[model samples]
Target: MNQELSESLDKSCKDLYKEETKYFDYIKKIKETAPNLKNYKTNKSKKIDQAFESILSYHEEAREVIQRKIRYANEGLKTTNLLIKKYVQQELISKLPGWEGSSNPPPLCGKIPANNNYIASNGDLVAASIPDENTGSAIILCHVKTYSKTTQEYKLVDFFEDLNKGPSYYTLPKEDVIPIPRTLSSKHLSQTEFSKNEKVLAVYPETTTFYPAIVLESPGSRTKKGFDTFYYSLRFVNDFVEQIEVYARFVIPNNEK
Candidate 1:
């Protein structure tokens, strides 16, 4: 009886080892072929599309995970203020990015109603006209509002370190930099004056009282030649405000030369 039991145990051990080796080999093969996998090959445009898709996917997944955790924790719990505080601390607060404290909330800002218009201008040598006659341009209006314990200020920064770094004339990818029409000279508009233009439609505060409302627009869209416009927004959270909210819109033209 003892000999038979020992033989059975030895066979089981050998079988387990064989299974483990098979799985290990399988994993090794996958890793070796991963780089050459057909699915990984993509054109530049497809890569960009994939990147954007990935960003959206991650955003959605994170949101769902946060909500699910919050719901699970709050199940059957009392709706008291203390319970609310505990649930947020245990589930939601840390999951959020850039969330410093309950006092400081993340700002929400995005393009509002999309507007596409057609405007024609003679290629002029003025501060607000396109440089070339053949190429057409339009204005883009973007607005941002932030509410929090801190006041927010917006500004556009030069994406390129310096013109001398590369060719003076070059076309930048729309994703790499904000599009600003070259027809309009950056020097022409003071920060405040630029912020307030007739093209400026409406600006309103968001639901959060702490967030301030903002409206911004660029005079044109990006083209093969170059971006007719270049602009960016800088939000400064006031020392007093803990949370910031932002909303904006970009006015693009219907056609581009």
Candidate 2:
């Protein structure tokens, strides 16, 4: 019976230790990925806090168990507990400063619509700060699903874990969103180079994909005559959808590619 109990205790300690190790590694990643932790509070940090709290509690319980074993003069249990303490103090505690620094959490969602079109009503992507099952928090973004102009309510699009593959229809609240901005080129397009009925490549806002389009109107629909840079309304070749308006800089001349 004593041997069985000892084995069980050892297994439990090792399992908890492994979990703590993962927490420590995650903290390191946060430090590298989110250096200005003070500016961006997020559910990710909250999960880190939960993990830290669990570690502290586990350490305390292990200490009590060790003390009991020592009082009974159980050499094996005493040694095992000492090792656990060493791992907690050395490996886990040493890396906690990085985690402690990430105090600011991200907002629940953005108040305005994201400036780009990749975020369609059902196409925009998003990432939650923590795992889905956990009740922590998340950030949001989009275009078609755009900001609810009438309501100011934003949908949680997806989780950060799936940022690589892309996100589908997942609605989150306004406070839990982080808008991902699209990068625009600094070089402006020349006005004379574009003309009506000219075939060119235009950026499709829905997926950021560039497709062949015919220029239906010069100075794209969004561009004003006096503006140095303008937008153009384009009819994508073979597209059954409505004409899309795009910035001059985003339109690529088919020859350039």
Q: Which number leads on TM-score?
A: 2
Task: Estimate the lDDT of model 2.
Answer: 0.46
TM-score of each: 0.16, 0.26
- Candidate 1 global TM-score: 0.16
Model 1 agreement with the true structure over 136-255: per-residue lDDT tens digits:
531112211111223222221111111112212222222212222222222222221224222321111211011122223322212123533333221222325332222222211212
Worst 10 residues of 1 by lDDT: 158-167
lDDT of 2 by residue, 1-257 (tens): 23467657667666666666566566556545653667547757767667666765666566566556545545665555455434422332233221111223222111113444322243443322323455343222222245575665554433321232244554444444433312222222233235777777654553333467888765523345554334567898888976776655345455424
* Clashing pairs counted in every model: 44, 30
Q: Residue 84 error for model 1, in Å?
A: 66
**In model 1, which runs have C-alpha deviations exceeding 4 angstroms?**
41-257
